[model samples]
Target: MQKKVNLASAGISAEESQLFRESITGAKPIAQDKIPPVVAPRKLKRRTDVLAKALDDNLFYFSDEFEGYIAEGVSLSWTKSGDDPHLTGRLRRGEFQPQVILDLHGMTTREAKAELAGLLAYCAKQHINCACVVHGKGLGILAKKVPNWLIQHPNVRAFHTAPKTWGKHGALLLLLSVED
Candidate 1:
């Protein structure tokens, strides 16, 4: 002899049963077309300043911005001297240097540029002089933009495409300028 389970003890009451039946069987839902949706079309946010400077319809190419960047050079004198032994300096320090690496995967030119600016700002704030940006293999996207952008940035002293183990073709070892 087995005992039957009482559903009422499970907290499902008669009122809930009545409500469910009324909602499913007695209710006639209004047509979707009869209801007006509450929403407006959104406007696109664009940067007029960037558009004005970018001669090409596209903003990522090596344009005058890059050319001008190459013309001017990193002026701040940075030495391999700093209290933080972990931070990479202007010159190669002994093994204690930290690998300051930035990853820019899945970023548009505008976003990447902004991020690069942020990194520069970070380096400036932290007094970090050297860092690496891992861009990922020639995913064939954001390719030229990374190098050219760094080339023109005010704080960048020099940058070279990284060799294999670090990130191969996808990374750049950047030498940043130190502040006075």
Candidate 2:
């Protein structure tokens, strides 16, 4: 297929276009590893506040695990619930403990915050498989800032939006593992 352009003064003919295509034909496809993974913003329910602070304090003992991934401005003293298992999937973080949150409809942000830490610690203590977080999709409660907070939390495994049958992204399915 010779794609010719009428460059009359240059003296280049239609046949020359074929050479340009042939020169690049042997290039290999790019490998998958060359690209970085893309993560989406997930939903998290935050109704409780007082408990959130307690959970923040609770994580203080495990300062070593909070070594690298924390946000620069966030205080080391300030811990979010489920802050124990941040990014545990690929590291030598030890146990595979998990926890779940159920039916977070009427709970206040304070309640939710408190409950998150309590649940995380409980799950870690039990060495459970995984827990279900039930944050029903209502009037944009946790959609604003809760998930972002959880994203930085230490105990979190990998939380994604809940399935339709499981209350959708209004709820987050938390996976907890032991701290390294």
Candidate 3:
């Protein structure tokens, strides 16, 4: 038990003590004197094995010999057969800003494929509809292969060579399908 002390003896003026008492006149003491312990939130584990398996089994096997050859300094554009006619035009015009950008610079074809798959997977998970893929103009290997890979992906609704400001000849803007 705690002993009650006199406010006057504690150097508190009578008026100040009266004001304090008045302020707490209707307040009741809290029944519990102790604070509840805080617990840390559980960490979420990433399923890298499953993602890797899916990437290897499902995303690989892109055709190395695509029928059409993309020439350097030229634009690339394509839209799914049933998609809106204006989709490619919209992409070309930069109407849909890229929510994510995957730069495939300095990566091998194998590495680029894995990264492209990962980017699409992330976009699908996040419900992002627009993305940009920058495949630099060095030797035009990725520049050509990127379009071929993108065209094969089921989620890619449309893609077009980005306009002057957005990596003109070296990048492609993608419109992805985010529907259920």
lDDT tens readout by residue for model 3, 1-180? 999989878999989988998999889887986888998998998899987788876575456665443544477888888989899898887799999998999999989988898898899889999999999899988987888888777888988998877798989899999977
Is candidate 1 or 2 superior in TM-score? 1
Residue pairs clashing, model 1? none
For lDDT, candidate 1 versus 2, the one ahead is 1
Our tally of clashes for model 2 stands at 25
lDDT of 3 at 71: 45
Model 2 TM-score on a 0 to 1 scale:
0.44
User: For candidate 1, lDDT tens digit of each residue in 35-149?
Assistant: 6788998999898888555423233333434533221322211222343333323233322232577888888767776667677767877989777777765554555567666
TM-score between candidate 1 and the true structure:
0.47
User: Considering lDDT, where higher is better, how would the candidates rank from best to worst?
Assistant: 3, 1, 2
Error of 3 at 118 (Å): 0.7
Task: Show where candidate 1 strays beyond 4 Å.
Answer: 1-98
lDDT score of residue 114 within candidate 1: 65
Instruction: Provide the global lDDT of candidate 3 against the true structure.
Output: 0.85
TM-score comparison, 1 vs 3, better candidate? 3
Off by over 4 Å in 2: 1-56, 59-99
Candidate 3, superposed: residue stretches over 4 Å from native? 1-51, 57-61, 65-73
- Winning model by lDDT: 3
